[model samples]
Target chain A: MNAIAETVMLDSASTSVTNAVVMDCRIEKIFYGDFLAVRDSRVPIKKNKIIGFIGPSGCGKSTVLRSLNRMNDLIPIFRFEGKVTYHGQDIYDRKVDPVVVRRYIGMVFQQPNPFSMSIFDNVAFGLRLNRFKGDLSERVEQALRGAALWNEVKDKLKNSGLSLSGGQQQRLCIARAIATEPDMLLMDEPCSALDPIATRKVEELMLELKEKYTIAIVTHNMQQAMRVADTTAFFAVDISQGSRTGYLVEMGATRQIFEQPQQQLTREYVRGEFS
Target chain B: MNDSHLSAESILQAVAGDAPRNLQRAPLEIRTLKSGALTALTWVMAVLASIPLFSVIYMLLVEGGSRLDWEALTALPPSAFEAGGGFGNAIIGTLVMVGIATLISVPIGILASVYLAILDPNSKLAQTARFLAKVLTGFPSILAGVFVYATMVVTMKSYSALAGGMALAVLMLPTVILAAEQAMMMVPKKMKDAAFGMGCTRTQVIWNVVLPTGMPGILTGVMLAVAGAAGESAPLLFTALFSNYYLSSLTEPTASLSILIFNFSGMPYDNQIELAWAASLVLVLIVLVLNVVARFVGRQKF
Candidate 1:
């Protein structure tokens, strides 16, 4: 590592780690118009750690992530019986504001969704919406730099964000997400649509970001989990008893889960034995 | 056979050394026939549509030419055909009624659209409201005039410009709602999600993102409604009551150009008929300008 990398790591280490857990969701049940999506489940998210949720498509991985911030509330038919807490506060409490929770827990979607605006405006959008009164230009610059996008777009800040290449647009979305200084970043297959080189750059950004914020990522790519995750959770669909709800098969440190899984399903999944 | 194959191979090698060429090009005869048919059909339809429009405009200019004087356009309203006055009061009266109608319809229509686009997608009430708006759009204009006459004019003891404008507004409400709703629906869902994800409320998302994005469409809808109001003679005949003097208030009986068009066109006097033709030309011109403005606004991407 170079001097700048060393300095960033050192400064990050010096800051006392938060003992408070990031997300503690105990979902009793999740439903989509009378269809139970996820059965009873509990997950404890550690602070400042990268937790990867690896599962097959339609296994309710994205559904769980959306529930963490109450994003599913927008769908009128989406019902749930759950108790989710962040920093020990009940997130589903009637007084709690999902909008405020979403602001604090930002998300980057599967596809790059930079607003159809200038690159600078895309980064500054969340900040302006949240009514951040500080130096907005410097904040935007810092966010772009943090997202590893500042060098490529430094001189073209006024250009449309939509005009950027796909990889750059994803990074611009990351820049937009971090502009608000959220506590945790939830990324849903952020690199699934990118090329290998772009994926590598995003992976590097994620590793660099782990020192500062907690991240929960849902991915279909197992190698991605092996590469960037500190902890990994394996989910499997239960087709028996006419129940297709996804359940957490196993979870452990990335090395232990890959090397010695507790459940046969997890082992088989890790070795690509069954989907 | 071997000798023939060897000779073909030699020819192929010679051709490959330069460039390969297509042995079979498109049939020139078939392409020529198709192009000829298409070109003839295009010209025939173009001329067929253009002729009636040009001829009507030409005849209108010829028949209404003598009455297009400055005095005829600028002078006050005349009760008698011998007075030879202009339809100035009628023009002003038309403008004022349309303006009031636009003001009454725009806010209600846009609000209804916003509600339908944002709130009605998943709700049964919203679906019902959408159905009602669609049905209301196809309602007859004369029936609207009758309804307003029964409700407002009968209660107030007289038909007034306010009653006329109200009838027009009722006729325009469904159109304005439907057009504005379509505009609001064109706003990307991702934009709304981004706004809401930024800690903004649903109301804030509608106001800041959806409304601004749909601004040009809302303007076009309002313009169409106003223009459609310009040609409605049936609604105004019972409401405006054909005044001979200037309209000072909304509640007073007023004479609009459409009402005058209907009344003067029925008279025995030749002068009144000429005046009616001039007013018709002016009405058509006003509607034409409004449509042009709407088209220009619709072309803007924002």
Candidate 2:
């Protein structure tokens, strides 16, 4: 009976977690010192699929995204009780190096934060960090091409990464991430700082990138989730205890969550009905 | 039972049809005059603040301008009873000792600050070191000389250039460390985050991202510390003592511009007094150049 119950539970998640290769992990809790920030998030990211996390402001979507690659470890007060695994290995294990985890699961932040280096150097940073023995120029070119920033930036590879347009700089950052050949990419609202044209370009890039790398993005735009995501997770704030903490309300196919959500909160959010 | 809706035009609300017009403010001239008064007050205070600085420059130029010759910089200091000699050795000594002090303090200060501001900033030891650095910034310079006099001077069994440099290094450390910490802290969190997200180790982040980004500010701090160390006389008084001739080695007594002025100002000879003024001018110029360079370096974008 317990085995049947577990099978039903796994089926309910809808992403079908039977494939045990990559991005099969769950987050139990994230804390800032003693206060619980986010809890019980169970959207196991799948391979070669783009998953979008959509929520209102301060709903811990970004926080959840940050925890995936162990980026939250940079904060001294940040604490976590979670199993974030990659390739069937628990990343938060004591023996695992956060640096190595970061290398394998690359991230792009909200702001276009290209290091203060030439465009070529920006892309080459990750490659150099891993001490890649391949042809560096060829690798940088491939990463830039993969990010769709090659045609515009190929001529000015020596220019500072900051000299590019905001969208270009973000693309440059993406190039920087994939240069190390990470299997998964975590992007935290990568287009919030950009304009409409740039946003469109980035959305297209994400669709193309899904052919190769698993992607999880946190976004404020519901239309964005509909446009690009294969699956979507809705995070909502819980304030019953006079404190705001975020929890995942539902995770399902993007169309199902938008059209016929299982939870009332998800329904209200999709309809833009709740305050 | 009394939950009646109150609409805009209900309950004898009689004045609801008119649109809101432009609001009146204070008369334009009165407002302008008030702003002008504030501006004038600031200008007056600014002039008042600059009076002492300008007066000092004027005094220095009048007293030392004519006496500042090539000879004053290239010749040895005049004796108590003699005339027409210069502090060539003192200029060389000041540069050498200040160089030594800079070499000793900058690396240590920058590393300590990296620990305080970047690596393990919240640890009890870092907090204590930060506090101690702040306290030492206010500690008396004479005490630094006295402390060095007890340690290096006593152990080396002589008053030497090395001792004076050590004394200045003691005074320069806190300034360098504190200023460097502020600079490192000012490096954008995003840049460091980007570097870390790129899989940089802590040391790699410091070396590649933090240090290079903070270089302008760090250089500014180091230059300011060097200026402060250059102008200090009390620290060198006991540690380096004074010499009339050129330094033979790092172990012998050294002559510095500040010490030269100190020794010459007390002499009864007119030429010695004039040389003192000249040395003061050079010292002031050195400090000014260092400050200007700090501003220049600090203003760089990357």
Candidate 3:
């Protein structure tokens, strides 16, 4: 275990020289009031890379994803031990504001939740909230283009965001997230509600977006993880004596985790032997 | 082979003089009968409920129609036993008093409701405020009048339009707060989550997202409060009293349609009585128009 830690530290130290470490999460445990939700986890999200979290239902993948950006702080009962650092600053420190953390680490939810406003307003919402001083129309256009939705929606910018199709709405949500220019994006099952074609589009968009922002996504679809993620973490729930608590099983390069998993549980998971 | 087996099974059933026992059951005629009876009953009940409304409207049109005229609408009430007068001053007075009341109550009510629905919704103070608002909705309109009479009219040393407006404001506040809170609460939680996810401050989310989304419903609440305030006669009696002339200032006693109807309805003169009916018709029309406007506004999408 010490050797493994040494190796991981060496690997991270070498990677930090070339690529920025956007978020370094060392979550000892997470609790919803008195109930423990997630056990220990250690994951370092690299800059400009897609990191996928694959786990079965109730394995706390989304919980860990949310905690990275302090999105879990919205729930009054939620509390976590240990530290989450963004750009070498402890985000969970007393002086740190969760709102500020969220501004820097934007999130996209499972279901596409576009505000009931014009398409332009939906993309411009985050920018407006942050009081973006740049040219608003140009910024909105840039965001829509970044999400690959500008051509389809440019003519109907005045129309309601809800008027868009399911796939387009998800892309709009992505545009809304990126408009604020956050350094990292946390997506929790973003493609779960979308169709296959929409899922493909989103996967392609994720690849394109990884050039500019770090992304951490939690998904149930292992194939999606294999397709889009550079790094993958497998999570599993321990239901010993009926006390269910989620813990990280393994983390490695996507191909290594899928093809030559170091952990037996990860191998079983990748083999589709058991959820 | 399948057809031969089916024919054999049919032959066996025919020999038994009844179709296979598990194959089918008798049709449910009772369901159709009960549904038909219930649908007819619902129609009958609906018609019965509408009868009183239609009858009141019919009475208003028949009794007040003869008194209505261009002059009646644009003139002040004549002396007792005199003819060819209207409640024009009363109409203007109602508008002024209700308008003032709306202006006072709407901002207070909407802001209070936003506090209850969005800010510190579970706090002890908000819970108390919510309970008080619910209790206030059932407060007697006459008591509202008396409240204004004591606080404004008595302090100022006379019944005035300002006092009347204050009384109506009190009556309207609770309704607006309750309805506005409900409307704001009806905004989906997911929308709020989305707003908050974008790192919007609580105030920004409420103002930019929640309020706009809930505007139609809030407008309906405001319109309903205005309609209720417009038709209130008991509250105006102590605060507004009665006036025969056009309103000079808010400090002076004002004429309202409800007050005019109340005062003239009891007079022995036929012309005064007819004028009272005319005022009642006008008051009803105003309330009806307000309700219709509420529906129209409520139907609008954000």
Candidate number of the best TM-score: 3
Candidate 1 structure quality by residue, lDDT tens digits, A114-171: 7666899889988887777789999999999999999999999999888999899999
Model 1 chain A: which ten-residue window has the lowest total lDDT? Answer: A1-10
Which residue pairs collide in model 2, if any?
none
Q: Interface root mean square deviation for model 1, in Å? A: 2.4
Ranking by TM-score: 3, 2, 1
In candidate 2, position A103 carries an lDDT of 73
Better of 1 and 2 by lDDT: 2
How high is the DockQ of candidate 3? 0.57
Instruction: Please state the error at residue B181 of candidate 2 in Å.
Output: 1.1
Q: State TM-scores per candidate.
A: 0.83, 0.86, 0.90
DockQ, per model, reads: 0.36, 0.47, 0.57
Off by over 4 Å in 2: A1-21, A133-137, A151-159, A238-245, B1-29, B81-83, B289-301
Tens digits of per-residue lDDT for model 3, A1-275: 23323433565676767566768999998999988999889998887889999988899999999898887887889999989877678999999978767777788999999988999999988887776777999989999999999999999999999989999999999999998777789999999999999999999999999987889999999999999999999999999848789999999899999999999899898999988
Give candidate 3 regions above 4 Å deviation.
A1-18, B1-28, B291-299
Query: DockQ ranking from best to worst?
Result: 3, 2, 1
Comparing to the true complex, what docking class would candidate 3 get?
medium
Candidate 1: stretches off by over 4 Å: A1-15, A18-20, A115-121, A150-165, A195-201, B1-73, B78-85, B265-278, B291-302
Residues B170-253, candidate 1, lDDT per residue (tens digit)? 988988998899999998887777676666789878876788678788778877888899888888877767788888877889
